[model samples]
Target: MHSDVPILLINLDRSKQRLQSATEQLNQWRLPFTRISAVDGKSLDENTVKRVFDEDNARCRYPYDLTIGEIGCYLSHVKCWQYIVDHKLDFAVILEDDLCLNADTPKVLDQLRKITTEWDYIKLASPYKFRPYHIVEQLTQSNPTISLVRYRQKIPSGTVAQVISYRGAQRLLQQRPPFFRPIDVDIQWQHELTLDTFGLLPYIADNADAPSEIQQLATRKALKQRRWVKLKELLRFKLKI
Candidate 1:
């Protein structure tokens, strides 16, 4: 049962190579998708960044705009939502420029489509290492395992990818709040509020290769200091005291 759902690929205008790799990967997997680029025409100026960040509502707990790289990704997501509305697509799979799919993604997505009605949201087909306290157990023998957890709960594993239904898409559009520092972290934190978000543990674990830029930036030499900064921010946010 092939639905007329669209898959949106978020990419940056300058990162042509990464975009090409992502497209090739999608083609290799034979998944139906459309590519969208977030173009500012001009370079990443401080003014542009501030303008985007300032657009976010201040009422939300997290109200910060994205960096240049992430703004591109978010714009892609926004474009995907717009495409759904314009083309009348029910749902779409939103993939970032950095993520690569595992072999079992097609099968997992197939299964997800079968049980779409049963879920409020369909997260990535990969497994996520969420905080132990945040992991909820299944209460009923339902079709798929989607349990309730805290909205602010943190996940240990990095964000991979996921599929979203029309309803899920609508919810995201409605709550266009500034996410945590990063969009991925915000997605994971807000997953619980949505209907359901699942992870294909084995697939993600097997495909643990980082993007070229990410690998270069997050080198061992810089990792420790970066981690310390991130942890400090996390601790401050969690305590709130």
Candidate 2:
């Protein structure tokens, strides 16, 4: 693993427009990243409807066959895992294509690295939703985890840029369950179960209607419904923890 971390951008070949926009943004910001397309291994030309159904069915089998969403999540995790094994990198950052970073990203990342060194369970650095009452001003070690600064309002849940430690990456690869619904939520739940999940204040902004099916679905659901869902998830996660 190289000491220098490379940002992995998950994308699909069909989303040429969004991909191009993301590429342009990265160039404009001069951020280094590796782009990988998430295509169904069975057939690249599969129709959009079929791809959607396959993804909904979660028909992501091994030996190359993969659903659309599975392809994205799998490739993202695989690339990170392979990088860790090959280069022995301590950690790396991962992001979807729909978000942009703030000007202080480099400095924030530096702080993230320092926090990771002090905590084993610091799996992700979420740059979205600045919630109140979740702040951990300085690096203070909790019994099982290290706490970081959090915002004072409720943070909206979704994919943003995140930095993952080597241990976190290994945990992801090792803890594959039978069903992986909402891959982001699954990983977040896993972190919650371990009580090692940390949030970063002041999100990097998730572009509206930016080519994300999951986000669209979540948007359609009522805010109250979303809150209830989160509450239920928390209860379920508490049992696991």
For all candidates, the clash counts are 7, 13
| Model 2: per-residue Cα lDDT at residue 83 | 62
- Runs of candidate 2 exceeding 4 Å displacement: 1-3, 39-75, 116-133, 137-147, 150-156, 191-195, 213-234, 238-241
Total backbone collisions, model 2 = 13
Tens-digit lDDT string for candidate 2 (1-241): 1235566676656667767777776666566777755533334245633533344334221112233455345444555555655666676666666666555444444455555323323323344443354665454343223346443322334554665666666665555433334444555454443424455433433543454631232332332233554566556556754
C-alpha local distance difference test of each model: 0.50, 0.49
- Among these predictions, the greatest TM-score belongs to 1
- List model 1 lDDT by residue over 156-183, tens digit each: 4343355566666666667653333444
Candidate 1 global lDDT? 0.50
- Residue clash pairs of candidate 1: 124-161, 124-162, 126-199, 126-200, 127-199, 127-200, 127-201
